[model samples]
Target: MPRAIGPVLVEGPVEVVLPDGTVVVSERPVVALCLCRRSRRYPFCDTSHRRRSRPSVERPADGEQA
Candidate 1:
């Protein structure tokens, strides 16, 4: 199933065929397929999509120590 911010869970030992005619296989009993396309390991989920950017903290000037 697809989640709002996660991968699609699938029963594994599955073979994925990419658009480029490349085939990838996984033999795990379960698999997480990347839906966000942000996975370092494409076609598989590495939880990369869950990462959120943090706001930058303001730093004091060099002469003025915090």
Candidate 2:
């Protein structure tokens, strides 16, 4: 019998039905739903959970300070 996986993490395609009767389909072998509302792919985790690097603010050497 076919059954729904979860809002939890899992592998393989997933079909999500919204309250408005909208159906969202994902065919990824490993699907990650966004819970933090930070994913650019909204509802899909595009590895946005990874830490982002910030620009360095340290000054350059005296001779290289152009």
Best by TM-score: 1
Clashing pairs in 1: none
lDDT of 1 at 13: 90
Q: Pick the candidate with the highest lDDT.
A: 1
For candidate 1, lDDT tens digit of each residue in 11-47?
9899999999999999999999998999999999999
Runs in model 2 with CA error above 4 Å?
Answer: 1-8, 52-66
Tell me the tens digit of each residue's lDDT in model 2 across 3-59. Answer: 423234878698867668888899988788766556677577666666468888788
- Candidate 1 lDDT score relative to the true structure: 0.92
Which regions of candidate 1 deviate over 4 angstroms?
1-4, 56-66
Report lDDT (CA) for all predictions. Answer: 0.92, 0.69
Worst 10 residues of 2 by lDDT: 1-10
Assess candidate 1 and give its TM-score to the true structure. 0.75
